[model samples]
Target: MTIAVLAVQGAFIEHEKKLEHLGADCIELRRAEDLNQHYDGIVLPGGESTVQGKLMKELGMFDIIKSQIKNSMPVLATCAGMILLADKLEAESKVHLQTIPMTVKRNAYGRQLGSFHTNATIKGIGEVPMTFIRAPYVSQVSDEVEILSVVEERIVAVRYQKQIALAFHPELDNDLRIHEMFLSLCK
Candidate 1:
């Protein structure tokens, strides 16, 4: 399974490493040309979603990715990646790809000092490690969006069709279940 990981910004390297560790071919997508390669799925890592979206647009990769996502390309979006996929922001105006029908509140956990770690039960995946660093929780999800995991009664993970968005960074943890679950979507 070849996976194209967006590497223009954020924790792309960590994601690439995890995917590789799972015995999947990892490709770092740094430019529009990089997106030309054949890949089974995409992984959007934790980072500044706004910056990543801006870089993607500037590099001419945003549209292609959005289209791919719309067409059912499996995606594992974490942290800021969740924000990028959200259709709306709680109190923000800008919407990135807006592919998922959900509302996200950016930095709902206060500042960097508010970061934390915890274990949560993903609906179908069971218990998994969740490392939240300046994460954003899902404030609302449409009927089509399935809530997967909740932390402190807040929506921390969700699955919509072939796309899965997590408020916490699974790649930052030692658990491979979440990543494995994502890879399973490719098959």
Candidate 2:
């Protein structure tokens, strides 16, 4: 299956590499037109949500991605990408691609120095090591969303049908179970 990674900024390249290592065809998504290409799934990598949001507007991708999610396309948003997918953003004012009904607080894990890794039991993926780098946490989730993983009692990973929002960087870990689970959702 083909997976498109939003390459506007952030850890998109890393995500691409992980997907490729999983034997899935991966592509860098730049323009809104790129979304027109056939793809089974999409990944929004961790980055500055404000900047990425602006870039999406500049590249005319904001609406297209929103539409795609509305059409039931499978998507995985990691870290800042999770902020983008959230229905409510508690940071700077910007247009977020509200794909998931959740309220997100950017940098909920403190500053860069607060970044750390830990072993967590992720639903459907078992116990896996996760990297949280200035990550955001899900403050609230709708009834449709399922809590996939948690750390210190906060929601770290969640899924709403085909859409997955992960607060940590699964791509940074050696385990491909999360990515593999996402691939399975594509099928």
Candidate 3:
């Protein structure tokens, strides 16, 4: 399977490495034209949501990706990537892709010091290491959204249609189940 990683900003390289390790061909999407390539899925890595959103808009990739997701393109979104897919933000009025019908609270875990690591059970994939760095949690999700995993009573992962969104960075962990699960969606 082939996947596109949004490399304009954020921790994209790590996701690329992880997907490649899973035997998937990865294309780093650095420009709008990169979206023209044939890819089965896309990965939105952890990073500053505001910067990533602005850069995507500036590069004219935002709408293209949004349309793709709307048409059922498989996507694996982590950390700020979750924020980008959320339809609403608890504190901010601006919504990015608005593909997932959920509300996310940005940096709900406080500052960088609030970063942490733990194990949680995903719906399909059992317990796996989760690394959170200034992560955002899902405060609310529509009836169509499926909650995948919860930590400390907070919703951190959800699946909607062909999209899998997470508040933690699975790429930061050694576990490959999550990445493998994402690749499965490509098939």
Question: How many pairs in model 3 have backbone atoms within 3 A of each other, for residues 3 or more apart or on separate chains, i.e. clashes?
Answer: 0
lDDT of each: 0.94, 0.90, 0.96
Q: Tens digit of lDDT per residue, candidate 2, span 1-187?
A: 9999999999998888889998999988899788778889989999898899889999999888888887888998999999999988776565499889988889998999989999999997799999999999998998999999989999999999799999999899899999999999898
Candidate 3 lDDT (Cα, 0 to 1): 0.96
Q: What's the candidate order when arranged by decreasing lDDT?
A: 3, 1, 2
Q: What does candidate 3's lDDT look like per residue over 1-187, in tens digits?
A: 8999999899999998899998999999988999999999999999999999999999999999999999999999999999999999997899899999999999999999999999989999999999999999999999999999999999999999999999999999899999999999999
lDDT of 1 at 111: 86
Error of 2 at 135 (Å): 0.7
> How well does each candidate superpose onto the true structure, as a TM-score?
0.99, 0.96, 0.99
Better of 1 and 2 by TM-score: 1
Q: Looking at candidate 3, what is the lDDT of residue 147?
A: 100
Task: List candidate 3 segments past 4 Å from native.
Answer: none
